[model samples]
Target: MRNLLILGAMAFCLCVHVCSDTQSGPQGDTTLPEEDGVLQLKQEHFKRALRKYKQLLVHFCKLHSDLSFKDAAEALMGSEVKLGVVDVTQEKDLVKELNGTSYPMVRLYISGDIHNPVPCPGVKTVLSDRISYFCTNLHRLSHLCFFVQELTNAYSQVFHAAAVDLPDISFALTQNEEVSRKYRLSQDVVLLLRKKLDCRKHFKTSQILSSPVLNHALLFVNKSSADFEEISSAFSSAAENFRMKILFVLVNVAESRNGRLMEYFRVRDFEAPLIRLVNLTDHVTYHLPSDTLNVEVIQEFCQSYLDGKAKPKMQSEPIPEGWDQKPVKELVGMNLEQVAFNPDKTVFVLFYLPYSKASRTLFPLWEELAEAFRQREDVVIARIDASANDINLSTQGAYPSLCLFPALYTERSHIYIWRKKYLKTEN
Candidate 1:
C-alpha cells in the first residue's frame, strides 16, 4: 500500500529530479551585475550535469525575497512536490539553520521544517567557478548529515510507513557520551532511526531492481501477476535505463528469515535485519531480547553486512608510475591497450593522466607503491596513459592491464597476463 506507492514515488521523483531540467526561474533584478552574471552561470552549470550530480540547483531569486518566499510556500502548501529553499544571510544562521559552514547553500528537505534543513553534501558543481566552488565544499559533519538525511528519508516513507506507533527517529554523533559535545542526537530516537534506515527493502515482484547502499527497504517487486520473463525483463530494462545496480531477494520460509546476498551471488539464510519485531515464538521475555525474532534481527544483520570483511577474490595488482619503462611496439594513440604481464610474479599496472587533476592527486599513491616495492625483487609495477595509448580503448571497457609471468624480468617485460582483471580495473 503506502510502501508500494512511496516506492514508486521515490523512484519516479529521484529519476525525474536527476534527469529532467530543474525548476530554474529567470534571474530576477539584482543590485550587483556580478550577482546577476553569477546566477546565470550557476543555472548553466547545473543544466550540464552528466548524471553524476544528483542534486541540481534551481535558482529561485524570488525565494530570497520575503514576499516571494511566502508566495512560493503558499503555492507549495497543497502541491505534491516539495521544495526546500535555504537562506544564508548571517553566519550564525548559516551554522545553526543549515548545520553547516558552507555559504549560498541550498538543500532539498523533504517532509521537514524549512528552518531546520538537513545538509545534502554529495551535490557537486557542474562547472568550475571560484565562488560556487567555495560554497559547495563540504565538511565531514555535513557529509555525514547528508548521508543520514538521505538514509532516514527513505526509511520514513516505506518500511516505517505502517508503524502502529511512531518510534523516535533521531541520530547521535558519537558512540561514547564523554567523547565530546558537538552534534549529538537523542539516543532513543537515534536508535530507532538507525534501525529503520539500516534494513533493506523487499518487494514481491522484480519490476525495478536498484539496491540501496544503506539498510532500508525499497519496493521493486511487482505485485501484479505478470509473467516471470516479463518481470525479469522489466527489471533488466529499469536497471539498464537508470544505470543502477539492482537485485532480487527471494525469502525462504525455513531456517533464518534474514537472507543476505553474498558477493558470490548467493542469498544466504540469515536473521531478519530490521528494527523492531514481534516474535511469534515468545511472549514473556520482553526486555528487548537481543536475539528475539523481531525488527532488531534485521538491524543486527544489516549492521553485520555493512561491517563484514570482504574476501579477496584474486591477488593484488599494483601498477607502477612514470610511463612504460622500455621502448617497444607502436600502438600509441588515445586508446588503452594491454602492454604485458606475467603469472608467477606479483604485477600491477596503473593508468594515469598527465594533466588531469585527478591524476595529479593520485601521484602520491603511485609514489607509495614505488617505495613499498622499491627494493623487493618479487613485484612488478607498470604505468599507462589513457590519453596517449596506441589502440583506442573503449570508454565502456575496463583498464590497467596487469600481467604476471612465471619468473622475474626487466621493466615492461612479461611472459603472460590475465585478461579479465586488467580490463575491469580501468574504470
Candidate 2:
C-alpha cells in the first residue's frame, strides 16, 4: 500500500520506470546525463536536488528497490514530485550518511527517522532540504545554522507522521554546543539524534493464545513472517473501515513463542507476510491467497469473508501411510509444519517434482543424506513433492532443491533456499 505522504511502500521493492537506457552518461560510472524528468545524481547533485525538488522521488541505491518504483515515477511525473536517480553501490558514503542500515535478510530499512531515513535510493523524506542539511551538517557557518534551526522545529511532526509507519527507527536533533563538539560537529552544524528500537520489546508472547483473539468469531491476523522490525501500520489503516465487525490482530512469526500460531494456521513454512482470517463461529479459517498484500487486498479479503464468498484455506492433504517408513521421510501438507520446523530436529528437505529426471536422480543422494544422520534423533533428512502440496516456501518454480531447516533457529539459521534452474519441458 502506498502512503501518499511518503508514498511508503513498506517492505516492497520500488519499480521505477526508466523510459530509456539509451540515455546515459560516462561508461563505468554511476552518472547519467541530466534528462528533464530524470536527474542523474552525484553527491553534489543529490544535495542540490534535495533543495530543488520539495517533493522529489529519487531512484538511488538501485539494488532491489528502484525497479518497482516505475509506477511511482510515472504517477508523480509532472505533478509536485521531482525525479533523481542514484546507484548506492557507487555511493557508500551517501548511504552511510543517510543512516541506511541494510539488514541481512535484504529488507533494507532506510531510517524513516526524519532525523535519518531509508529509501529506494536511501530514505524518502518530506522534510525540506534546508532542515535536513542543517540537521546533519554541524560544520556550516554560524548564521546559516541559526536561521534553519528555527525551521526544523516547525515541521518535525509532519515528517514524523510520514515516517510513523516505518519499523522501529527514531530520530533526534541537538543544538547543544558540547554535544556538537563531542561528535566533532562542524562549527555551524546541528545534530540529529537516532536510535534503533525493538518494536516487540514489550509485547507479551502469550497474547495470541489469549481468549479475546481466539473467541472472536471474525478475526484478522496480519503477520510478518520475516524476522525484522515489521511495519503493520497499513492494517491499522485498513482496520478503520471495519471498526467493530472484524477484530484485527497483529502477529510476529519470528519469536519462538509465536510458532504455535504459525502452525495453527499451517503457515510455518510460508515465507511471505501472511493475512489469515479465522471464523470461530463457523469453525473454519480463510487466508489471503495472494503472495503480495496491500490495503486493497486486505479489504477485499475481509469483505469476501463477511459476504460468505471467501474460500477456506487448504489445511493439509490426508497423511500418507508409511510416510516415515523410508530413510528419507516423506512430507505432505499435513505433516510439514510438525516435522520441517521442529525446533528439536535439524530438518533438511529436498523439494522436488516427481516427474523430473533430475529429481529422480537425487533419490540416492537424499537417502545418503538421511542415512548419514540415521543414528541421531535430532537430524531429519526429508523430501516433498513440490507439485502436490500447498507449501508456501519462498523459493519456487524449480525442482530437486535442498533446504536445511536447522535446529538452532535464529534469523540467520533460517533456510535461504536456492532457486534451482527449471527445464523448459517442465514449464
lDDT tens digits, residue span 96-151, model 1: 53344445554433333333333433223312231233222223332221113332
Judging by TM-score against the true structure, name the best candidate.
2
User: RMSD for each model, in Å, please?
Assistant: 24.9, 21.6
Query: How well does candidate 1 match the true structure in TM-score terms?
Result: 0.21
Off by over 4 Å in 2: 1-300, 303-312, 410-427
The per-model lDDT (C-alpha) reads 0.33, 0.55
- Per-prediction backbone clash count: 46, 25
- Ten-residue segment with the worst summed lDDT in candidate 2? 104-113
